[model samples]
Target chain A: MGAHTMEPASSSWVTLLGDSDRRGGTTAARNTAPKELLWKVTLGDSIRSSPVLAAGVVLVTCRDGHLYAFDARTGRERWSYATPASVHSTPSLSGDLVLFGCDDGAVYAVDRTSGGLRWKAQSEGAIWTSPSVHRGTAYFGTHGGVFNAVDILSGRTQWSRRFDGRIHSSAYATDDRVYFGCSDGCVYALASSTGADAWRYQTGEGVTASPAVKDGLVLVGSEDHVFYALDAGSGAVRWRFQTGLGLASSPAVTAGKVFFGGKDGHVYALAVADGREIWKSPSIRQITAAPLAGASLVCVQGFFGTTQAYDLNTGDTLWTASLGGSLGSTPVITDDTVYLATYPGVIYALR
Target chain B: MNRRTFVYNAALGTLHVGLLGTQLRAFQNTPSAPTLQIDIQAPDLPLSKLAMPGLFPGRVVQASHAGSLLNGRVQQAPVGQMLDQGMRALTGESTSKEAWAKFIEPSDIVALKVNPSGTPTTTTSIPLMREVIRALNAVGVPNRNIIVFDRNSNQMEVLGYHNLLPVGVRVVGLDGDWAIGGRTRPGYDPNVFAEMNCFGERETRSYMGSVVSEASKIINLPCLKEHNASGVTGCLKNLAYGCFNNVARTHRFPKTYTDPAIAVLCTAPPLRAKAVLHIMDGIRAVYHGGPFAWNPDFVWEAKTLLIGTDPVAVDRIELEMVEQKRRDVGAPSLWDRNPQNLGSAADMDRSAQKNRFYREPGHIKTASELGLGRWELEQIELRKLQIS
Candidate 1:
């Protein structure tokens, strides 16, 4: 089979934590509060993967070890394929193939249209990071400290690197480099083509948050309670902001503003240039997942199971909806719908 | 008669419940009736077999000190002394140090699996944990090697356990990140798990905590309490549910009993092999409204500590003690769910009436069936001592 290389439409979210850049920043505008409810579907178990919309289908993985595809508008079950173990890794769409890793230590490529297995490549440990597919190569890391670059079409390893600790951070791929965080408390930048180490920035604690690279700054958070921005080329620290506790939330950069949630339960908006706090919201419970920055509103899913939307420019609270269960997955923002998943296996499509 | 009626009759000490033929036959050969005979022979059996006498065989030591608790706090000195006497009695060793040496060594990394759930009054007392640490230290296990842990980090933090323990004694909460992600943190070892399809749950496997897999030995420290779902939660439930992740999926709506699940978990190779000691804190026992401590009226100064290697045997004794306490308070039996007695103090003061599920105290016997330990009253030799 030939590799499908259709560019995602500007409005589609085709990868985990938004696009392959892992920016989680969207430009699609939508009403903050819609009067009507869309549709909701229950899955087999809790979901930790953010939903990705590709070609009118919403794709999400469940703790029950299944990847489910639902009709985006109607919430009808399209198809589901089960893996050997639970999947926390969000799926990346590459043409007609869906690529994701599983806790069973295998990276799978499934046909998007028929839900059939295309190819599977085994890894040494459980994969918690979503695959970042760039130029027909899938890049991801596993808990076993193995970072792999697999060919998307044939499911063959191009190159693999070993680290000292687990990797939970998904890779953010640019034209030349891929950036990710590791449990060994380091943010690593590697060449996209050869899987060679480009630069490594050490943090005080483990780095589980995926890197958000905008302009020339690489922004990531560490469990050491510090949010760091480093020079993308030199790996030198540009600025660091300390919070009350550690941070596992990835930053969402949009419109010259960087938005991130902290383990201390506060959401902070900072200037992308100098890392100055623009606004800090009150404690909304521990924010572990990345904040979704849409055109006019910034939506954050708190670990306490509430999804709240704030004014993107003012950081003012716009609307909040309780999912009634813990949420580890990031929220998906479309032009008309915001898809959120809760730990109790319920997926809510709110417009 | 229905199974419920038979259980009610059995709880009332009626002899006419013909439905209990198996139990009647099992009890007929017991010469001491309620008093258990000591059986020390360790049986060789498969993992599926339920008749292993290897877990402390037939002995259980219960040491009671009247002044162990004062002003709702456990006196460390008296509890330590009581622990010493109980260990001596349980192991047949003359001194506490000698008895402790039988179970632990200097080079071993010991994990003290403490139950930190429920209210302050019903949770494992910090004083008792100190005593356990002291005993471990006396046996030459270093402070760094001693880990005091519970399932939830937040609950342990809420109970002030992190600050209460000794400086070098590492306190860990296994599921610290559960609230954040719903998935248990990396603290659970994925390699070691108990897989069983109970009640058709989606997550059929319960992974053992990393502490259990890493430690050379585990000392199960459970508090004495009446669990609304499990009837009574003592040694078996503590090590079973406490040491494993994803156990809440076992007993959900429509069916709330953790019978086979608890037994399967406790008998899992990782726990069944590593867990060598069972020390149940009964100083403040809750006859009702527990696992969580909300109703003070149902709580009392039990002033007792049950120590044994046989979790099932210890749990069986705890079950009888809780049943007696429930009877003394005019509460319905754990098995007989009479909704008519809903507003009583023993029924979680009626606040937890709707939340309460069908109780499954028979998990102790189920563990015994799985060859985890002895559960029958006739098979257990209980040594009751007063350490004043």
Candidate 2:
């Protein structure tokens, strides 16, 4: 049986803060030039998870165990909820509820308006991956090595599938299919509704990068040191990119190119058509942060607390900023500003 | 069908979906339970010091004596005899009391820096620490004079040291005082290790220079273990823990030579000379999948004790024992990493091979490069004795 799929829960549109509707569609008015520095927010610890933007609130999870809500424009903290463990998974916003996994071993649903707890379902191990929400069900992976689909309001599980290793990536759902990878060297496409397996692709080693779905293709990186593309429908091999080192970052797909950082120290832009390297940058030592896709820029976070912007057209280095320590958090860009947090507790709103 | 039957059918359909989710959630939340292997061994008898290697290239100082116990039995000798052995190995006829005074005085507050990086379930062995406390008291050191410490309080609590601290001794974890007002300068830093050390340059800007400098003497208590990233986690690893701002840079890349970062960490400011003595806890050892192992069964119960005033002698003994134990266990040596270990052994041999200078421990050799201690191991005398 294939991995199950769930019908869309709410057909009613939920208007969020973005110029485009949710799912990160690009707006025509985005500025392509280098932006200025906006305001900066200092956190108590490093921000390791990506920030999710929705419902006028930018949700960020910090290593200090707090899920912070900030005004997307002003960077003022709206409300913060403390978890029993670190919040390594970026929160998923579904309507008025924010769904995310915490290292505390629980999946939490908090009210979007008040930051109030709705319901929490406990997992066996720490939840380090961001959650993917569809219909009324939320799908996510856990350190316990399970991919789960949970009901939003009732905190009940729709279905779950087990793997031989831990899941470090958020499950990406498209139509009725859910795609995710495990550290056990496999990428799985499951039917979201019934929790049955659809198809699986074996990588050279354990897959730690989150699977990205674009144009019927599922792209992911593996510890075996390669980035792979597979047919979303049949789980057949589409193409593969052999990196000098293991691909630790999730593939960010845009404009027919897949950008990812390899452990061997280089950030490469690969042709999605054949997994051919279009252009590769010098090794950045360790590029683990998944690059953020934008209209004109590819934003990447790297070691020694550096954040850099590159021209999407030429892969030219545009500008760089110092974060003081490591930049583990992925950048979330707005129409006028790019917001990111560093491991040393500093949050920057670059305009 | 009747109207009631139709309503009941619709409700049942909704509940079926709910049931499917409940079952899935249960499966997702359930983790494979850890297989617990618990073994308790009676403390080994008649503890004796290991042989110290002779001179090498580095600046290594020899310890006049070796292991000495405190309040507990060593199975080797009485407290007085152990004191005599340690005294003969050291420079003076100073009693264990005088040695205590010289190492730490009543007014001098001492920091017993303990390496808690191994498994949280295991520690440096309670009986061994109790013996060190006994020795301190024998030397006229007060109960409150010594503070046992690590970087994280939660781990210390997991190891059951928090409740044990108030009993006339101080036990502190570096994270205990994480708040703004509670934080002390040069002690705890959250921002030190944000970058990679690939080019092998400086990685940190500010460090905890205060907490370490405030202590009169820092006694290093480390575990004997195998490290995949660094060759060994010994006294140098113990001292480097305080010197570096971040440790994640080493493991962020798999093939990166983390040993250089460790070597540089020992040579850094504040923590190098602060290491006054080296005591290796070899009771419960992890010869595989360490410095932290989830499977506790890998731990071997070896009732052995190693002590020396010279960090080099202490470390050299540990490196050899680690290699010897790996061989005894029928495992490949750490040098098999080939390229990663490319210059690791040669760099170590330069400081530890007993030839031109006194052979030293790797950390002692690195610290000696930073001018911390003598690197010669032969100058160390094995004042081995029975502590029963």
Candidate 3:
């Protein structure tokens, strides 16, 4: 691993940035719904990957067999790098390098500022999960059921461990451990230093949902429809909540409330302690987007053109809007702006 | 109007067969007892000239045949001649179904289960799809009553299917709005899908599918291709694509009845066994990435169309072509690399690596064993029509 420093830069509130992750639309930050469509740029093919904003540049991966960088506000083509196959993984920014996995079974690191290529590490299967960085260690899962830990700067492999199935879930990083789940029905905690297994807990079915850790407790959901809270250090199950269906959406923890969506067409808020139910709201359709929480608002997106914001405490509706298409992307909230993506190849910015 | 009149004449003949007692012998000769094993013995006459026997009598009759010319072992002919022979071999009746159904009313709906997921180059051709629609229309099957469906939206769009079909002949996809509306309430299993089997055990799952069940007659238009997991995807593959929520789950246990499960799921009493006619599109064969073509090189242009009511027989024949291609390419058979034979669950063998093409599709054999159709090539009447 090498010493790394990510430049601190800001993106203007005027333009929309990022890849068409999940769905195509991105929410804009404004008092009124996005009116001024920034510059729209066309690539070679449809983009299924999400875009991440860092250092004033938007890093996007496209099915057109390229990883692209553009000015966040201007949508001007900055630079582009071609790959062997599709890049479905959303690029994660770590310092000056952007890390992403491609369908060609390789993890690539590119210069975030210059859009220049850095280093590439190969995997057995395609990498659809975004690489999560922590303490100079980068972690991500692959289609071949392997979780790899690589040095972010040099792209050297630290260690690799195999599971029973594919790993579509992205990695979550804390201080010493990188936690994630796989299609093999197991959630694993590995030491970020050497990729050695710290702990593993099996679920009923596959665990494609990502994990979110806070304060020594790791919260994650599984395809088995069970939401689990594990001991951050030992990977022991602290509490598990059984939903009516498989849980694909990652859990978002705020205060004492854990918000997530179940495939049974319901968005649930559960007490993080002992896995008790708090309040449940029936989404009009299956909720694929992870829930985003602000001060008093819980924003949820559904697969069938619906997005709603509810009062965090009482489950009261704050606002509801039809996006005119299915939305699979998680909404990112920044002050007053909420950004999301839809399937019809358009991103919407809602204020 | 002439074709409609011919259908009317055929319907009158069918009525006469129903009324007369002499037709019982023709029905007795229909060969209802399903043949199990494959016999290599050649039939007495050439299959092309032979009139293929029918399974059901009064209701079903032969429609016109359709075929495409190939470079080797086949010749090219006019479109009308090629389509007529192919349609004749497909329907097996001398006249259209509308003519034979004058005494009995014609069906209101016809579902065409198309293979949009096959390799792009070898997928069902637009001409073939158009001919099927045209022939059905000649039999008085209205355009509004016809529907062509597939598993994926992108695949259907790639094959240029949306533009080929007439406006009345709706083309539907799995992810499309109309198909999504067909989704029912969540079954016993809480998976994202609408249906489920029993808990804790994996067996043949029984669930309601509006598209599969509601069709008056199903015309399965599947592309013949090599499948990495299921051995070969053909008419039987349609069952998997048409019924299940997530097909990737079927690969959990290797060689575990994926092919047979699809066949059983469709052939079992209520789900589909009633009204299905398979039209295997061999226009372009995907010798390899299959189910989805990632590599364009693996595709080959084998212009042929295979029609059969029995899915097992159709797939067995198709699988034979895949095996021959692999053999010609000097590669291993699907059996040699079958992943199911890997390290046992009881013994974790560190050296165990998954065989890429692991496991022969047991479904066809199992389907044959269940008394569906003949597995051997000898029993099938291979009608090699010279389209040119």
Candidate 4:
């Protein structure tokens, strides 16, 4: 088996959007929201992939068909890899390699240190989900509903299974199971070893949000306007919270609170145990990206207009940044820095 | 003018249109639709000769080939045969190229409004999409002049339409942000729109998709799916709902203005004038819960294709096919307004069969009365082909 790193980096926030738990959108390493503007840089085009910080380098993909690596401190260009088509898959780190999916229908593994091509595994359709690295394997679902598990080091297919609906949800991997939501309106948990279906829980509309797993529950939001927490083993509904509209954004679980944004333009903080609303913010612009739950603050990247930071406990607005272009990428954060990418290809580092 | 006189003028057409200039874009008829109350208005724009019921009116062609789909994959040669046979039958032209040339020109910018809402299950067939692009190319329309589009860009990408299409063919998504009302919604023309008052909510105007305004002609690619709110979604709903922004407001739970609203939106001059063809993909038909793949149990391999210049006639047939399939499966009719079926369960991501709203399948007949096409069987001709 190829050696891949599953150990967490000391302080770097490496979530494509969320922490390893996924539905928990990066509240692990960061307990504070950065408030200072440290640096910003414009890339070739707009970004859809969230920035992942690893080894003092920020890795992000662009709509211009390029995967770029920048110095975490100065936002300086470190190295870059180019793909044939635009990339929506955020760079996921596994061992010495940085893996991401591309619109060219390939899962690319590039050298993390030099951005050199290690191997590229082609799939049947374009992959929009981030490669979920688990136990020396990279898992992802494609736009065509083809799910593949590739060897992390060799970039060879381990096994593949096709579902009935398209898959936009990135996979959430545990030791024994991998979970993902599908446009077929179902949350699916597959046996990690064999890539076989373990259980499936149906939702009303399509589920594009990636699943977040913690405490034996798989949590995800569906386009049907419901946030569901399902039993990990059997896929039974543990609880569900209804929102005004559907959810394209995933959730962040931290300190027993689940923070999420809704397509209906509201930010919600709920108790993780029973899906009870702790606090719901007033309506704002629509949000399609997951929120970052910190120790005292929760930050949300809006689909347009502004990115706001709210009091984690009270849902009170703390700060708002009205960036010129639209914000779509889910921002990553550290203890004192927030690295966000926006439309028209601009990246901002808040410290 | 009184309502009676207005009705008289509406029947008289363009003559009364100029005289009653203020009400020129007025409601075509006062439909006593039980569930929905709607008033539609548009600017009095000039109608093109190739509008709505273009070239041949009241004619529909159904092409069914059992071989079109082989083991879950759409077979290329068989689908090509289906398109060829359906087009030839619809136009009465010996050659497929000649049939396509009836409406499309080498200079025209053709917009293909494809439904990607229900991917993998009921979305436009990739084979059919490719075939349409090939047919357009054969008609001397270059790939650059072709635009394939849907309502949501995200869904389009998720469905892989952009990657599948030819390089030069433009793929666009008409503005999103259904609930966020503001100038935030781009990709829609502000000037050309259909204004209506349906559920007493604000923002009564629905704008035309910006791509529709730029294109000279549109070839509709609607899937055969039973819509929860509008009954069966075919041509009229495809063009009307697909081309307009903020249209989901027409259906809100217990009721919807989908009937008259759909027909009235079809009468909008800019949209109605440019829609020259309708091709319904029935390869995988969703008979019960749909527009979304709400339930895969309701999906059946219909192996059928429909073609027409008359939306109302084609949709009527599409409606019948969906209803019959529902009946065969012991499912409630799309037109089933039985009070017992309605449920107030907070609409969540639960795909239950509880009839939520009174289904408004009469949109087809309302569209016919709006002069889009023929609705009655006696007024139309259907040519069916069985291809081996």
What are the TM values for chain B, all candidates?
Answer: 0.81, 0.63, 0.67, 0.86
Total clashes in model 1, counting residue pairs 3 or more apart in sequence or in different chains: 3
Better of 2 and 3 by TM-score: 2
On DockQ, the candidate that comes out on top is 4
Give me the candidate number with maximum lDDT.
Answer: 4
Best by TM-score: 1
Q: Per-residue CA lDDT of candidate 4, range A51-82, in tens?
A: 88876788889877889999988999988898
Candidate 1, residues A222-287, lDDT tens digits: the string is 866789999999899999988866577778888888888885678899998999999888887467
- Candidate 3 matches the true fold with a TM-score of 0.50
What would the TM-scores of all predictions be? 0.59, 0.53, 0.50, 0.57
Ranking by DockQ: 4, 1, 3, 2
Q: lDDT tens string, model 2, A136-238?
A: 7888877667778898778998888777667776678766898888765688989989878899988755577777877778888876667888999999988
Query: Where does candidate 2 stray beyond 4 Å?
Result: A1-36, A325-327, B1-235, B238-388
Model 1 clash pairs? Answer: B50-B369, B50-B370, B50-B371
- Candidate 2 on B158-197: residue-level lDDT in tens? 3334322223455555653321123334345433221222
Better of 2 and 4 by DockQ: 4
- Cα deviation at A236, candidate 4, in Å, is 41
lDDT of each: 0.74, 0.57, 0.57, 0.76
RMSD of each: 11.6, 23.0, 22.9, 12.7
What docking grade applies to model 2?
Answer: incorrect
True contacts kept of each: 0.00, 0.00, 0.00, 0.00
